[model samples]
Target: MAQHAAVDDLVKLLTKANYDLTLVQHRLDKEFQQIYPHNANPLKLVSRIKKIQEDLSSLKEECRELLAAKQDLIDKARTTLVGNRSLLKRMQASSGLPLISDSDDLAYTNLNQIINEWTVQVRPKTGDGKHDSDSEDINQLLFSAIVQNS
Candidate 1:
């Protein structure tokens, strides 16, 4: 009878330990979800964040390329003006075209006019703070800079 009681006590202890362990695991699982709800399925959330980062990086690269292209165009236009002035001077000397009083001044004026017209037509303009109904991704910070300049 004593041996039987001892065996029963041992079984009861084991059962209690198992129940406690299960309770602790359930509590831990709940805490884990609270801590990182999005990471409940970690692989999926990681992939989504990676894709968003890639898209932002691509947009930044495109903006850089556009700015570089604009700078190159400005430089080429300036070089063309210089070449045009030289060509005009040569023509006046050899072909007997009426010479301007100041060829350099005329060239500078023409370049300025061309640049002004190009800027007005090609540059993006920013309007008021009201968002456009059609466009969703307009960055307010960048648009504000454009507005101030305009």
Candidate 2:
């Protein structure tokens, strides 16, 4: 009777251990399934990460190209403005007019006044008078300078 009772107690302990092990395994499997569903491909996660990095790199490259284009445009406009200012100074000197100082807003105002006077003088006084091509040339130069300054 003692031997049979010991065997029966041992069986009960083994059965309980097995049930606990089974429960733990099921819990671990559930957690794993939540992270990576059974129907989904795990390799696609790495591919998605790679695709995001590629998109970020492309966006940075596009920003660099746009900045370069804007800088090029600004440089060209500055060059044109400098050329126009130099031409205006030369015209003033060649016409025996005093050199307008290169400093201050007052100088620019004086230069504009001179240009206006020249334009007025160049126009034909009589309605039938022939237009001087020289006057037309000066008018075009003055117009370009005004546009550049503005």
Backbone clash count, each prediction separately = 0, 0
Off by over 4 Å in 2: 1-51, 96-100, 105-150
Cα lDDT tens digits for candidate 1, 1-150: 999999999999999999999999788767777776766645456778999999977876676566556656766877897788779889998998876656448658877788666444433444444433222123333434444565
For 1-150, candidate 2 gives per-residue lDDT tens digits of: 999999999999999999999999788666766888854534555667899999977965664555445445544654675578789889989999887666654745565565446545434333454544453344444444544455
* Residue 148 of model 1, lDDT score: 57
Lowest summed lDDT window (length 10), candidate 1: 132-141
- Candidates' C-alpha lDDT: 0.65, 0.62
- C-alpha TM-scores of all predictions: 0.37, 0.35
